[model samples]
Target chain A: MTHGISMAGYMFVNPGEEILVPSLFWGNYNLSFINAYDAKIKPYNLFKGEGLDVAAMGAELMSEGDKKILLLNFPNNPTGYSPDVREMKEIISAVEQAAKAGKKIVVICDDAYFGLVFEEGIEAQSPFAWLANLHENVLAVKVDGPTKEDYVWGFRVGFMTYGIKGGTEALYTALENKTAGAIRGSISNTSNLSQSLLLEAFDSPTYQEEKKEKFNILKSRYEAVKQAMKNPDYAEFFKAKPYNSGYFMCIELKDGLDADVVRRLLIEKYSIGTISLNNLLRIAFSAVAVKDILALFDGIYSACKELTV
Target chain B: MTHGISMAGYMFVNPGEEILVPSLFWGNYNLSFINAYDAKIKPYNLFKGEGLDVAAMGAELMSEGDKKILLLNFPNNPTGYSPDVREMKEIISAVEQAAKAGKKIVVICDDAYFGLVFEEGIEAQSPFAWLANLHENVLAVKVDGPTKEDYVWGFRVGFMTYGIKGGTEALYTALENKTAGAIRGSISNTSNLSQSLLLEAFDSPTYQEEKKEKFNILKSRYEAVKQAMKNPDYAEFFKAKPYNSGYFMCIELKDGLDADVVRRLLIEKYSIGTISLNNLLRIAFSAVAVKDILALFDGIYSACKELTV
Candidate 1:
């Protein structure tokens, strides 16, 4: 997702141009744009109390007054927020309206978590599917991999796919040549040996079965986290951000305590590890041993209360 | 080498600044600097009939009149020319003189063919050893890998080491952070699995012995190539570029035949595969069998005569 953001940043948005990201975004996106491309970040509100604020996002996109990149990372890292189908359409419509106004729109859909859907209403599909040919100026780029989908991390393999509306095959070819030429200039290519492993995994008879088995386990963990948060005791220290899909659920510190301070106290006091971003504590329920999911939140509850104002 | 070029390019040279490369050099360097970094390539004469043209290269460097990057790859690809110590000193002297003239020179020594030396007089040692820290204004970067050195192309493991004169360890540390940050923005990092494989290769009991065995075979092929070119029949068609220390050697056409045309005809008529660049044909003897080395040149000689102008 960060690599996609970086490439899109340099390729599409020049230095000093504004990149409109949701207030809630993967931290790496900042590094990707600002550090890598020298582009500035302009944040729109991401939530109306844990539900996606498509209106604020649309308003920011429309009123930004310049051509910009729309980077949408679904089942977003840290927050694990995925837009439902209608919200996804609203996201596309914002870009479409902006593009229709003669503004160049580079819509990058970072689908790192493509199919980890546990929530009923939210869609796991990428916005790129419908938004790709949405407008002529919309250079839709989809960055994805079986790295997260197939549960392989060390592979370091992913792809950057493009779909630009009203572009000829020749145009796309040239764009591909540049992108690939950039890759050649960068890492040559991803590992051929890792590709072989992924290919074999794709061909294996148990591939779907194995993937389903892992997906179900993750789904169970999601349910466990939901149940864990239902405990009344945690309400005093933090407010749970609505999360139904993906690996994490964020807890906003309610007593106005610093998240990192609480995080340190949690480590020192309760021997629990959690990621503190801004004022939110992110809990990854994906790899939490099934038996320990509830106990993990219990630890968080105690740590928060101990340091509460 | 390409990655190092990309980093050294953006870090050292500005967008429009020119990079001076040898006339006979890897094609990727052009793409690496220009496509990725927007830096242009300025070619210096690499050969005076059969050896490194240090004097011409030195003159080009002196007269170009700008703070420039001098990129040199030794055990040279496609041409297989490694400078002897005296020639290397002459090459360093060019940079030294340029630095003395207040031109900030960033000398990148690409050591891809580090240990694959087959000649007695030529030094396979990196130019960074002597050039680095030699001048206050000169910054030296060496790019090398186990891909060619350990005969593990699939691993794709390489390194970038820097040496800047009078540079404190703190400055180097900061430079490293920026380099690492830039790399993070591009490809994250090289595959750790590949690193593990390379580490194991390093630890193997027969590591040095096995490398020596492979080195001996490549050296034998080099001798075979040098011996095969002694045929007077080949002399009429093409003059062999004086190659002594690497995988490939070039044959400059004597009869003014189109190298690309001869290349196509050779593939169709004699089932020969060789790289055609400008008026030269490159042959890699590293992988060719010793017995077939003579036959390969025979095919080239025949093709040259058949396609003669």
Candidate 2:
């Protein structure tokens, strides 16, 4: 909440400035900016083939007068999509053009599900490391938390870093003071005990090794989910999007079926709850067991067969 | 911060409504109500004889019109002074009359330093238990936190309970829903880890025993401070107010001696820091060692002697 508020405060984009957002975006992005910051969010429909709709993003940026900020999310929420190197370069070029055009483009990468790319082709990179030293006009604000990565949902421990010109020390000091002021004015400070616990965990010798093991287990489970979706009965109900990392996968419902109807039937009749986004349903593969994935799909398939339009 | 915002949000008394405040009030109250709520703060000046000016409080209540909220703090900050039974009764009477006048009076008892009353005559009680059930109009809102009580400053863990006409269940449910909504709108929720840790601490058998021992230690330290303040060199410098609980005490400086001047000298020359409120210099006994109490006063006394006035 603190980080979100801080980022929203710094977003000084002018009226009608086109900020590119993927069609498959987190609901909170709209809530945080359009609803909260009162900035315009121009949605670029995602490219059918890979990661982000880079070509569409570039065209949108060129079409709009001047881009002030480009919002990016990797290992994306609700879709579990990560842009490959080629697509990333195209996105970067569009951002560079915005920067060169004298529009102070603040790239806010909401890396909430960062470092969780699972698919064979998809690889993740910290945008902070990539764009921090790039240009004076191009500032990258990275918002990441322990909620997803460290499996500490209740902790609410997150940090925001600004990559700007001048040494890291100067940038950090200015950002820290502003951030601390925001914190003091809002919630005062994060839990002293939570910070202590996280510090302890980070300093622990086994943390990295244990985290890697957990990541591998999640990856295997995701693979199982992908393999199970290929089965005949479930395959006919929906088309599974290529998901490399993160907990969720987006499944496009069949033409005649309603995603919300399927979601309600699955929950009420089958005791399964999944999130429906328009014509798509997002299933969290991380929570369900590998052995149970097939059974869960079978149940969903059965419900769809009975309740389909 | 959450409690502060909630209090500010609901503290919308009509233009003529009187809100009683202590002379040595928390700074935030001024910001929250006077500046924000636009409510008038009628300060009941603390008497030099009695730690709390309860007689003045009662007189003010009897004289003023109805529709008032009496804000009380015990084991008070910047002056760890709790009122005796006589003073407590006067305050109770003041509240009772306000209730009888058909005024919806809220007795906001900030029990931040609760369970720390050390003196025999200056014991503390849960005002909610006493005054809340007295009249339907007399509502008691007890705002306390584990931050100070549990020695966890950074946790930002606080609880608020409403004493109302309904049974405990209904009151709790209403309070919970309102507070939870406030929390949701502000920071979404408190740190889950902090809540878990606090719950664990409360459930532990040895927690109370350990806390009692710490309380005794604080009590002893406060006693030492009282004895040191009685020293002849310091006694004449300022009027000593009775401090039985909490972390601090305020010394009423001589008529001509400026508190800021004294505070500055103490900090600059002696490397000691204390807060100043007009003519009063607040000394925090909790942060300093017991044995160092006399020495600290000695520094203050010498600083006072050096002043030409």
Tell me how many clashing residue pairs each candidate has: 0, 5
Taking the tens digit of each residue's C-alpha lDDT, what string does model 1 give over A113-211? 888889888876888887778888788889887767889876777878899888898998988887777767766667777788889999999999999
Q: How accurate locally is residue B256 in candidate 2, as Cα lDDT from 0 to 100?
A: 78
Clash pairs (backbone) in predicted model 2? A118-A244, A118-A245, A119-A244, A154-B192, A192-B154
- lDDT per residue for candidate 2 within B13-64, as digits (tens), equals 4444567878787665654455433567788876657556777776665564
The reply for model 1, stretches above 4 Å from the true place, is: A1-4, A64-66, A165-167, B60-66
- DockQ of candidate 1? 0.50
Q: Looking at model 1 chain B, which ten-residue stretch has the lowest summed lDDT? A: B1-10
Docking outcome class, model 1: medium
DockQ of 2: 0.27
What C-alpha lDDT does candidate 1 achieve relative to the native structure? Answer: 0.81
- Kept native contacts, as fractions per model, are 0.43, 0.38
